[model samples]
Target: MTAPDDLLRGVEATLFAATEPLRADEISRHLGGADVRPALAALTEHYAGRGIHLVERGGRWHFQTAPDLAHLLRREKEDVRRLSRAATEALAIIAYHEPVSRAEIEAIRGVQTAKGTLDVLMEAGWVRIAGRREVPGRPTIYSTTPAFLTHFGLSSRGDLPGIGELRAAGLLDPVDEAYAVLTGSGEDAADDGDEDGAGAD
Candidate 1:
């Protein structure tokens, strides 16, 4: 029988060599039926204080730089591509109210959502087509992807900040005040307005 240390080494090597994150069952199978839970737990604890951390995201396990230490390894460069206001607003809407249709998004924003806005988010791998809503015309619904959570350093959608938190962080716009009122009461205001028609360049 392989010792505990040997088991940990095997799991470590497998994870290190993987191009993508691996599930625990996959790790167990790789070791020819070795029980990997304890080894994984041990490895997680062992790496807790290290520069790199073993973390599980979207049910897959991988190593990531320690949050505070990550700045040290980042290369400074100009970020030429930035999300447009429309895209940013759409993304926030999806993150907060997932599996929502484009029409629903527009209803919340009180403006017709541009196709390119969703396109840009899909191209970024942050949003994906969840499925069709079981309504008339069956419009496609959108939801945030695992990559979205990973990019934002969130473990799940529940980790997203609430309205109060956003306000405290000064991340909310004045227009968001109206949004807060709408969403707070679980009611959508009348869209007696024109489509904003904003698009990403």
Candidate 2:
């Protein structure tokens, strides 16, 4: 008979190999239920003292490399990507409160974002249109992309750094504070002079 311990090792291997966080249902399907809990617990406990740790968030599970290893990883290559104050704010709003409309973004920002703002994010492959809102005149909604998670070295959106983390890093630039003083409604909601204006594509 296969030992529950071996079954758990299999579960742990599967979990560790996944690039994205796995839902419990998916994990359970991979490991037979009778030994699933014991396997999961054993794997979790086994990695407790290691450089990597299994983490659960937003009902999904994944392994995260330890923060202590960050500096060491940095030595492997030069980090090149750095977001500007406005870019960071726009990204944050999209990430935390996704499927948000441009109008909503303007409201939070308190001033209009330039045309290039969303374009830049999209160009970087970090943001995309989630879908159009089901309201009158249905506006297109935007949300962070999986590429955003990968670029940030996060296994999922839940791993996004909080306000406290930003403040601690001394990288918290209050882009919104300046928005309250601006006059553009915090959105570039103007018509693009398209011949088929108001037509949904």
Candidate 3:
């Protein structure tokens, strides 16, 4: 007979090692079981004292460092990608006014954004292709994902930092400041490339 504790531990280990969140069904399938919630609960309780904690959000499971321990991990705030001025402008426009098309983004920024810039954001699990706009060309529309909120520590896009926040943080340079706002650092950076979540990019 397979010990339930063993099963729980296995699930916990898998979850910890995962680069992105997983669904309970994904865990159960990996462990050859139909129901792993009990095992997951047991594991959550077992690791309740550890530095990390397992959590479920948006139907996905992830292990995050305990809240109290997070400060220890804080580095300079930064963006996942070191976006160019044009890219940053484009992203900001899309984020604030989402389900927008490339044309709209270009119109707002007054410059044509490179496809690669959007690709980079998509790869970062922040921006995602929502659907085609109902226009003559049916251009694809882009929007921020829930993961964007989670990564930015926001409950909704309405919580996105405003100009005041940027001014207060003294992150004025559009490029570096954008990264700083997103990643807590101010350097030419790149995406970690963990886009496994649903419609991640």
Candidate 4:
């Protein structure tokens, strides 16, 4: 067994050179299968308030800029797309009820989801096709991706904000309000886009 001090240092070096976030087991494999959790905990504590802090998202460990100092490094911000109300709604649905089918999404939305809506989310790497649900036509199901966790800084789906939180954050809207107050969050009307046969695909 490597000495405690050496093990800690080795774990730090391995994570620092990693091209992407690594799982604890992956880190252990790199250290000749050494028990890496203790070292990881120590490193996590060591970097607690530093410029870069170790964080685990969706079972992967990586260092991200500390919350307080992140702005210092963002000299130029990336121009990212702001999700439409429909896209945001669909995302929340998938996050809460993952491995859900397109028909389920439409049913919950009370409107046939436009084909491009899920496409937009997939393009953003926040959603993915999880495979066909085992039934009738085997409709494609959707789920939030790990990148969704990373982008949102969530440790897991369990970390997703609750309804009250979303309402407080001003992210919740009339559609959500209607859905919550009524049936399983379904709206009262269909969309013009879907009515025009865009939902046919």
Using Cα atoms with residue i matched to residue i, what is each candidate's TM-score against the true structure? 0.77, 0.62, 0.58, 0.78
Local accuracy of candidate 4 as per-residue lDDT tens digits, 1-201: 489998898889999999888999999999899999988888889899788899989998998999898778765853466555567667778888898987898887777778888898899998999999889888999999888888778899877657787678575654464333222234533233323145445
Best by TM-score: 4
Ranking by TM-score: 4, 1, 2, 3
Better of 2 and 3 by TM-score: 2
lDDT of each: 0.77, 0.65, 0.70, 0.77
For each candidate, C-alpha RMSD in Å?
7.1, 8.7, 8.1, 6.0
lDDT of 2 by residue, 36-116 (tens): 656667777888789987766555677877767766656555325444456656776887779888888777766666656
The TM-score measured for candidate 1 stands at 0.77
lDDT of 1 by residue, 62-120 (tens): 88999999889877984444555556668778888888999888888877787887998
lDDT of 3 by residue, 62-115 (tens): 877887899899878763455555455566677678889988876765555667
**Clash totals in order:** 0, 3, 9, 1
Question: Candidate 1 overall Cα lDDT vs. reference?
Answer: 0.77
Clashing pairs in 3: 76-184, 77-184, 77-185, 78-179, 78-183, 78-184, 78-185, 79-179, 79-183
Clashing pairs in 2: 111-186, 112-186, 112-187
Distance from true location, Cα of 82 in model 2, Å: 2.2
If both were scored by lDDT, which would come out higher, candidate 1 or candidate 3? 1
Ranked candidates, highest lDDT first:
4, 1, 3, 2
